[model samples]
Target chain A: MSQPTTYSLSARIMHWGMAFLLFSMLFAGLAMVQSLQPWHLTLLGLHKSFGVIALIAVIVRLVIRLRTTTPALPDSIPALQKRIAHASHWLLYAAMFAMPLSGYFMQNAAGRPVAVFDLFTLPAIMPVSLPLYGFFREVHALVAWALIALVLVHIAAALHHGLVKRDGVLQSMTGRKK
Target chain B: MSKKTPSALPLRYAIIIGAVGGLGALVFAVAGGLGQSSVTAQDFVNLQEGGNPHLGFRRAHAKGFCVAGEFVSNGSLQPYSIAPQFTATSTPFVGRISIAGGNPTAPDLNAPVRSLALSFGEGSSRWLTAMNTPPVMAVGTPEAFYQQIQALSPDPETGERNPERISAFFAAHPETQTFRNWQAGYTPSSSFASEIYHSINAFYLINENGDRQAVRWAAMPTVSNGETLDAANANALQDEFFARVEAQPVAFDLTFTFANDSDDETNPTVLWPSTRRNMIAGQIVVHQAMPESEGNCNEINFDPLVLPKGMAATADPILRARSAAYAESYRRRAREHFLNSSLQPSPQKESENNQ
Candidate 1:
């Protein structure tokens, strides 16, 4: 069967939406760590809200990805390049899910309820354990850094395909394929 | 016609994604548990030990008097806040009036600032507030304050602070110059009541309508009767304070000033302008005074984090840090007899005749 030329509509929406949310999360997280201003609390709430959104979006995106066929790499692409692309894509997915799950559990371990935009409280799923809280907190931070690095690499790869190689691979996700 | 089974691609992707995600989580859990450990309660204990050789003294404000008082509410505060202490007609309070510095024997003449730490209400509903004479704090964040303390701490071998370290800290944290200037501008008050005590950290006041306002409170003396004493009478402030309060209650107007858009709630080092709207919350009347040993103040931690309903702490790192330091001080003091000895009533010394 011939590979699709572009991602499905649902896939495109989820991809862009997650991109905006994750970017906001990264900046908010950084600001909260550096300063303890009155707005810091507000930013923290937003960060947590975005994290939850990212988690849900990633799950939906994963399901959609499983049902739909991803556009194949151009025939000119090297086998090594294709393998690297496949591995990085999976790693990004792993980081996206890990960041929020770790943060949610970390807060629970610290004996705090996760309030989504102060609209509703998510009950603590785990018992209060300082050690567990420390572990999860570290994991959340470390995964965030890893995710950032992966995102930069992904962006670079896409630019390489679009600008350097003049391949249609980048346009497959962008929905700009002719 | 040959027809292939429905493609197994989706199932294969699902398995691969699940396995990779599970593996990533496992790696993070193990790496994180081994890599980052949160600061423990022991760190605070160690910090205190490193700062002071005198194990029984407080980490700061080592010299103080235990006083009994009542905050008489004018009832005007009811609209702005529902805190019982602010709205009630009157609520009895216990507090310590102390001078800045960790030396219990530090002369009142040389002390840079005075402090008032009070606990209002009784039992479970009690609230604690630690205030100082300065309108703003010396340092903004907990880390900066901690570094300041470390910079000023005496060198183990020299038994005096290294000048280079102190200068480096001051140069790096230029904001602290405001606090230092404020301190240098004032002479030590002859009485704690004569000085204006400010709750340097900003707090949220939730009104009856559920409207929240950011405010910092101050207790201004109603009377200016305290007599200035010279260096020869270095110990006169506390003595005179006790004598005056015993003769008549010393009172202060408890006022709250609302924060404007320009105000920085997190940085206590930044003082809000006086032009901001102010309201008379109540009056704090010190009816009686006693030496630290005779008063119940030693038992109280006076952590600013302890708040009644309608009063909440802001994201001020210094305020949050105080809670932990105060707790550790209270814990260590409670365990040792030497620390509790300061609370034991001592015979009053003969007054020096220096008019």
Candidate 2:
């Protein structure tokens, strides 16, 4: 069976860019939390800034998706696999947007300026509240780990389709066999 | 299933974006906006440097502490200590120079860090704490700052700084390179007084007109101006500070140079190029001295949050965080001292042994 034509050039670019961004952000976040030298602050700032960029890109990508249809999965693929793909995609969207927002809220709640690179500042959207701050912090932390787990699962599923299943699902996203 | 795509977002979307952006910018302008809060040297000296209202002196006091003193350096041998009530007045202030640690005779270059404080007065209002480091740190997050401290502490197994671990951590986190440049010739364990510079991480000041500004308190040793530590001149740094205090009690003055928000923001690190543009606003004098025999040094609480009007702390997140952390650390140290009793040896005893 043949694979259908896949994502547009713009969609593919946004997808891959967002992927690289999200993964780099995850590592940078981990490093920032793990290190404390004066420079780690730079890392945290970069992480946050990149996270915001990914989020914006995600929004634009979503808009593009709404304006242009994505290629459908192969009919031969199992229904369960399709459902997993759909759920994972939505989860990535949620994470790409939510993580940056959570961090922004966290800094704002602490009365800190949210600098993307110290280049431009993002305005605070919420007032300071210890309880709400704590809630967002917990969510931010849990979401980070959840995102990590989900990304790992994503990698595994993609590999299963590409290697074990030798299916075109993974290839479609990568634009390798569309 | 493949579905039909929707059309692009309408021009209304761009209008919505512009309106949102415009409204946000306007509100920021009204609220002093982005530029309003960027702390200037004038802000520090003029004492107009307001903090996040939710976490200012009022909130800090609600959480259990208040700004007790604002010691501004008048560029004299004597620095003045302004109480939260004192304003627009300048006088000679007392300054104390010492080595902080378990032992008294240790070399200054042995330590990777040094702290210098100018005690502007004889009582609770006397202290302005500064480190011998430069360029403010980048770790804006409180949690990251704390974790970094633990990582830098003496190794649990070796009872020493684990070089491999420290090196790896430094390599992994390259942001420490600036600090590393400062620490290259210095050791992690030494008498602080012997170092060429003494600093206060976040210090603020007030001017003649009761205006406030944010400042870093630095003491450049006339004798030990270079990075390399001279064992011979070690005593010179301490002796000069004490001799001047002993001669006139009011002889020495502490000076403070203003750090505008722009310069501060650019280099948030301690290395603010002290030699170049930093300005000295006021002076302080030493009236009376506290002997190691007084035994009250342990009870002393040197908090940067204790600013007077005409001298307000900036919204510098690190300053805000450190004020709370320092207070908590001070409290915890006091509690530990009370509980252990023998945890810290007397500096007098150590000094006598060296003699």
Candidate 3:
């Protein structure tokens, strides 16, 4: 097998696309919960629709990540750091899938239909139950905070790799070819 | 893998980085929760609409009719704010006129507080959320307001407010004595058509060249009637307004008043000087009022913080508290509706599965 130095173009595209959508939804959801602006409903609609799109993108991204030849960590990295890096990445994948699914089910438990930009709407699949809705809402909110915290660490690590370590790790998924 | 030299992050510091980030998030969640500790949004929602809220209703202004109208500005506030609502543009809006408290059945003529909540649709400016009160508010902070509500709340056993708590609140805030004097001399308006709605919190209006002017606005009714509404009839107030609107559009001159340099913009308890100049910024002609069943303005939060580009909230703690409390109120009411209208399992689907 050939040892690749960077991620493929398709993986890079998916990474950036999902990153934009994820950040936007997080901030918009925060704003929507805090105020009752006229534009908030529009924000809600976009959040739901983009969440669905993210769900699809994540599935494909996961497949690509698994099938492709991922660049190996540098020999300078310690064994403990490598394990932690691997664990954190898996946690992120789980969170990416969990976020959208919980929100979708929360809406389902509320017995409200999810509309995709007014083009189409999906009907509720679960019976209307307050407990279920509450559970999902809590999960959605908690996961959001966790995801935000994780992203902060992730960004710092990337900066450390690029600037401090002067490693090509940051360029692995940033479209820079070796 | 490449020829370039690589440096590794220390294992000890990597864990610390994530741990610190997690700690930061936890701190934010605790510190930035709603409003002040004593006067949280959760507290307001629980006290007012807690056990069983009226589905699809506001926690405070629970009962109100929706008004559809067009705001016609005279461009008088051009020097203070370039907000579209202050320009000579006619902006369509929907609003509500409500009384104080969570109980929708509260008597209209006997209402201690009359409220006006408006959302300007075409214009980006936030809603003009106000109540019919003196130029200043009764309390300096939202914590005081919440404490006053708590003190006045009827005791479980006695069904009367605790005299000690009431006295303690009054004694602690000597500034509230002015409110008592104002309340003693106040007179109730016979109709919603006559009462003037005052925005208790002050806002800074940003003009061209980034100059800031502190200002307040009120919706002053065009016509006043000495006619007293029927105190016995629960629907009498709404009926009167609806009937009057059918004949002619009830108009209110939307006016903005500039604040003096010495005025205390942060404290709601201190009244602004009467010598401050007033300019008629616009006129709102409410053509018709839709019933609560229509769900027009009934669902709006009227968050005062959702201002246009040119307008900004001052350092008034009450204003910040209002945004948090209002958000909590809207969320609970909307959730109540969502919970009440949950999907039921169909018997037909079960029978079809049996096949």
Compared with the true structure, all predictions reach lDDT values of: 0.72, 0.49, 0.72
Give Cα distance to truth, residue B257, candidate 2, Å. Answer: 4.9
- lDDT digits (tens) for residues A60-163 of candidate 2: 98898788777787788889978988989899778877888887776565434555654666766776443344456666767877777677667666665554
Better of 1 and 3 by DockQ: 3
Q: Score the docking of each candidate (DockQ).
A: 0.03, 0.02, 0.09
Q: Give the lowest summed-lDDT range of ten residues in model 3 chain A.
A: A33-42
User: Model 1, range A91-175, lDDT digits (tens) per residue?
Assistant: 9999989989998987665444466764666666776443455467667778888987787667666755654455777788888
Count of backbone clashes, every candidate in sequence: 2, 64, 0
Q: Which run of 10 residues does model 3 chain B get worst, by summed lDDT?
A: B342-351
Q: How big is the positional error of residue B56 in model 1, measured in Å on the Cα after superposition?
A: 4.2
Candidate 3 CAPRI grade: incorrect
> What tens-digit string does per-residue lDDT give for candidate 3 at B53-160?
654467887766788898998888877777777777898887888887776666666667887778773324444455555656778776677777877777767877
Top candidate (TM-score):
3
lDDT of 1 by residue, B1-355 (tens): 1232357445544554555555455444533432222432235455646755344456567778899989999887778778887766899998898887766666886777789888886422457888898888778876677678778878889998899999899999999977888877866566777888999999998887888889999999887756656667655788888889989998899999999877888789987887999999788999999986677675556767667667777888777656545645544544443224433322132122112
Model 1 misplaced stretches (Cα beyond 4 Å):
A1-178, B1-45, B51-56, B230-234, B337-355
What lDDT score is found at residue B184 in candidate 3? 86
Native A-B contact fraction in model 3:
0.02
> Which whole-number lDDT from 0 to 100 does residue A42 have in model 1?
60
Full ranking by TM-score: 3, 1, 2
Candidate 2 structure quality by residue, lDDT tens digits, B65-86: 0111234433331223244324
